[model samples]
Target: MRKVGVLVSGRGSNLQAIMDRIADGYLPLEIAVVISDKSDAYALERAQKAGIKAAAIERKACASKDDFEAKINAALTDAGCELVVLAGFMRILSANFVNKWHHKIINIHPALLPSFPGLHGQGQAVAYGVKFSGCTVHFVDEGTDSGPIILQKVVPVMDDDTEDTLADRILVQEHIAMPEALKLWAEDKLVINGRKVKVLA
Candidate 1:
């Protein structure tokens, strides 16, 4: 089975969904380890419960950004991780770390992307009065969320939707898009061309 490393900083609902997919034999890969910058993150707890290796590499403990990245890179590399998945991983990786993985890393963005690329994506969509909003799963590049697209799932923005409600709805799609994209990766169905990703037959 293909081995992968997962990074998380929050509750890790996405991580749980991905792992569930794997256990159900829907995702053709294995989670080698789950690393988190926050020791208290529930994602780490989830990983531990599943009998997977869980690591806590706090950001403040490191002397410098490079040092922090080196530790993280070493962890994944030593674990023989072939792919890295960012499941609500809060830290912004340095270009060196990003380039190390390059196309091997994938991230889930909470918006359609190329719009509201950073945090508070749901709030941005609500404030912007968009009638529709969604999530994007794309390859992690040096740029923020401007990487080549993998797959997207759209959710309509209800008129009375608040940030929390909109986020809840988008999260459902996130859970769907993430594992589906991983399935494509496992099948070697993703062909990156320029700024686009083509799904193979």
Candidate 2:
């Protein structure tokens, strides 16, 4: 099994989904460690409860962004993490850090991407009156949510849908897509070529 490190900054609902899959033997990857940028993030508790190594590498505690990411790199490297999973990790990693990890990092975004790239993607979709919105799992690159796509689950936008309501539905798909992408990665079934990701059967 490949070892992966998870980064989180919130409640860790996605982290819980992954943990559930791992517990049921559906995912072949092992969580080496979970690092949080906030000291008070609830994801740390979730990781510790699962008997995984967890740490808080607060960005504010470090002198610079480089220093903060260097500490994160050390933590992941020491834990032998082969992949980095971003689940509600609110920090925008520097280009240097992204290049260091290269395609080894993956993230789940709450929209189809190439449409709403940054924060509040679900809200953006709702505001734009799009007929459909969805969640995307993609490889992390230097750009914001502009990496090659791996997996996506579409959700139809309703006429009466508010941002919160639309976000709620998309979040469900996020839970599924993120784990599936990680599973594919663990099984070595993901192939990235330029701006595309091909999944092998």
What digit string (tens of lDDT, one per residue) describes model 1 on residues 1-201?
999999999899999999999999999999999999999999999999999999999989999989989999999999999999999999888889989997999999999988889989999999999998999999999999889999889999999999999999999999999999999999899999889899999
Q: Can you list the residue pairs that collide in candidate 1?
A: none
- Looking at model 1, residue 152 earns an lDDT score of 88
Q: What is the lDDT of residue 148 in candidate 1?
A: 96
- C-alpha lDDT of residue 136 in model 2: 92
Question: In model 2, which range of ten residues has the least summed lDDT?
Answer: 173-182
Q: Which sections of candidate 2 miss by over 4 Å?
A: none
For candidate 2, the C-alpha RMSD (Å) to the true structure equals 0.6
